[model samples]
Target: MADRVTVIGWDGSPLTAAACGALGAATLVAGAAHHLALPEVPASAERIRLGSVDLAARRIAGHRGTAVVLADGDPGFFGVVRTLRGPEFGLEVEVVPAVSPVAAAFARAGMPWDDAHVVVAHPRTLRRAVNVCRAHTKVAVLTSPGAGPAELGLLMEGVHRTFVICEELGTDHEQVTVLTSDKAADHTWRDPNVVIVVGGPVGATEGGGWIAGRDPAAGPRGWTRPAQVYGGELGEGERDVLRAAQLARLGPRLGDLVWDIGCGSGAFATEAAAAGAAVIAVDLDPRSCARTEAAARRFGVQLQIVLGTAPHVLENLPEPDVVRIGGGGAAVVSAVADRRPQRIVTHAGTRDAAERVGRDLSEHGYHVECALLQSVDLDTRAWTETERSVAFLLSGELTRS
Candidate 1:
């Protein structure tokens, strides 16, 4: 076990008194070369150049003397502090943090970041981060070498965004540059940087919200819609009951993209959006598209309403985490299953259709569940269980077994 470790954060700024004292007393100091070169590092202390955090932690665990780890910005915010104290190392540490890079970039831009979505880019998950930048108004991306401004700007062409690239923040070599997405794609940027992306109108990129990333009051209170508010028929099927049944199966939540195929009036799309999932409602009818947009507006939820038929229309759209089909029965299910969404929900009109869809999903490596929804007499407003089932709902998830 390592001796008590002091994790000190730097933002090209002067160290706090406690951090200075810790560095002065440290017998073993682990940090980057530049951090070790600082005047505050004691002349008598041994130095370990940091490459991998785990490696440094292991070396520190065997050292019998006090150790100090130096890092950039706030070590607690996506920094090395977690790894140093993680279950593998389990080293006792006291963190002295500085302003995070995201906060520093936003401050330089003179914008409030309470409503801004912050994404840490990685090699594998960069596409999802790009999609999030496309969907939200204000975003701050903590960029790495390959996943930095250049890569992000290339994907954001014609997306109507303002890119503020802050390089070498809080340092003498710091550069703050502002440009369109096109310029960002063409220009080269320095490493160890942060990018603040703002979309929409100049001042409308952010709002006064209580929460950090999402406004809790941005949408309706519940996932079920009131019939009279839609200004059109809430569609053919009884949505409230169906929505209640599918909520658990679909597991719609923030950061998920939910696709509604053959959306009649966008009821489920709007509900899913209000439930914190990004929703895309697809319908062939122009009237249905208008109705979906209107319902989204009425409920204050954001929905991408696509005016096209499914199976073909779904090709160009971003991959979804969940899929809900309202009209196209078995064929649509087959098309969506090919995409390998985490969850799938659709309505089947007959037993044959349900079994066929179930068998198809099973073949596609999904665990399937089917249920016939119980009907309620609308006139009596009472639940009634009968052999005459109104609609059959099927849900599927990827299965290894």
Candidate 2:
């Protein structure tokens, strides 16, 4: 007498009596080959193997009688249930949830995951998943067959991160291996795995404690100050010039969201956020995120640092008013242009990268302006030596033509 179709979660375990009854009564049942081979599936039911998820959704949609869709782990968290039960099909699904792979992986690692950022790495969009691993301190990556531990480790080669790869969770072949980012890249791993990146320190497990909404203003602490004010081991005079030029090019205003791509020292983002704009700094290094956080605290500003590589990660963030691409190449410039920000600025160390930025912006309808500035350092001898560099500043405005 149940009116709604049921979507069941099977975690490689024997089906319960309640699940068996549902499966037996189902006129149509769809799941992966591994899931369909289970003994609990009724002999007479029409079985559709899940090759393409969209195709499986169609099979479930066409069924006239009681239909059942089986998925692995929690169907709600990055699973097929969301796709199957959407408005296009108008099929109401009763979900029987199971322990999510992310949860299981974290549990096996003996780590708390409530504060961890969760991402999925499928064949289609693994780069974004890599970016998530780069940007956040603690992350749980639900990996697909081709995008497992080795692949992830390879993509995150230079970044300093600790990888805890949990394979075949809840199954007999279950193995958990902890490795440094470099070590993980060197080894092959099993499919259906989860990759956990511990961001802060190796053993430190705690939330960043960042509250939602605007951060408290550093009272009497001016937001944008001269780079010399942030004197540190890394804050050299040459860096000061670079910081000043970057800030001048970015021109972040109050309430604007600035995307400081390839934020090296977090100087630009820190200065902008101090100037009253909300800043999200993107970098591939976890160490960079830590450094940026420290710099923000020192300068008394709210700057959110995302540990991920760009172009892919940028697609997932909110559109920004201003963008600064301090590194990466023409692809980075083109990606930011696609988002159609009010202004885009890029600093290039090489001539080839500079030309690409100029051409890419022009093609995207930007009133592109490119400039190459070389700053000369006057040392104790009072002899000036110019540094070699080039920058492209592209400004896009409303043009009727």
Candidate 3:
């Protein structure tokens, strides 16, 4: 018979009959110290404190009798159940779930969270969680010790966000504090907390969304759209064909930050935002910034618009994974290179500018490449044809650390 494992979730509630029975009869119990200390876990059961979950899973798999793994909240929702269910483990599990922390956090705040994007921030991907907060109106960040509210608050300096900080949920020490993102840094928040980053004001309630998260599918249907879609100056922004080529080179993806420098019509910025990347559109012209904001609103995506000159304006923004220099010359290219983005794509209106960018990027330890993207349209009725303007596309990747 397959090894029988019962996964029980404890949400600071009195144990159910099934959970109590499983724990009472467990031959081996694996759980956190807090869970193990619960009176329901029988004295006869051998306890394996959950340090590395892999180690705990191994102990449970090898045990001769019924094994119970205790977890917090719903074990299936971004919790321990997935690790135990892997094929390598060869175990059959029955899960008894209690409330998830995400649900409890929202309940404590007295708001509906059907629309909130829930992201967990570990040491490696903390910036990504912050980026989601920057781009979305509603987010619940499950934070680690080093990646908690203080770190999040620092990143959210200028943004309009209300933080509902819930610490030690479902415990006697549980506390929920409501503060603006700007003010969150002032207090040292306790660990084992969830921060609800609301885009507007604190305690604001939102109507139910059809789908969860800041929906990636909520925006324009396809990319490389016409300039009129963004309401930009006609024939000024990157045309559909050129935009397609640039997108291919830039490669914006989920949980990434993309900078659209000199976002003329907000075309590229909106497209990247729609593709699930947090986007910052920078332009010297106030009109361009306004247009980008309007385009983002029209498409139901978010773009952080900054009206300032390049290099100078790029300083305060969050680090970008990918950058597309739609405008600015060699100086801007060199400045961007200093940031050491994983990938950089620059479009030069002229061949001379392209050559300068390629050379500069190559010197900055990037594998630089250039492509000339040109297209032609034919007039069938008039029996006339004309070649479209040529765009010099320069793309680079970091070659070294």
> How much lDDT does each candidate structure score?
0.81, 0.71, 0.84
Residues 365-388, model 2: lDDT tens digits:
777665666555555475655443
Q: For candidate 3, list the clashing residue pairs, or say none.
A: none
RMSD (Å) per prediction: 3.5, 10.4, 3.0
**What is the per-residue lDDT of model 1 for residues 96-127, given as tens digits with 9 covering 90 to 100?**
99999988999999988988888888777666
Stretches > 4 Å off in candidate 1: 153-160, 180-184, 200-209, 377-389
- Give the range of the ten consecutive residues with the poorest summed lDDT in model 3: 200-209
For this target, which candidate reaches the highest TM-score against the unseen true structure?
Answer: 3
Off by over 4 Å in 2: 1-3, 201-229, 232-265, 269-343, 346-401
lDDT measured at residue 212 in model 2 versus the true structure, 0 to 100: 22
Stretches of candidate 3 off by over 4 Å are 1-3, 200-210, 234-237, 377-387
Candidate 2 vs 3: which has more lDDT: 3
TM-score of 1: 0.87
List, in order, the clash count of every candidate structure.
0, 7, 0
* Clashing residue pairs in candidate 2 (N, C-alpha, C atoms within 3 angstroms): 134-307, 134-308, 135-306, 135-307, 135-308, 137-199, 223-274
TM-score of each: 0.87, 0.63, 0.91
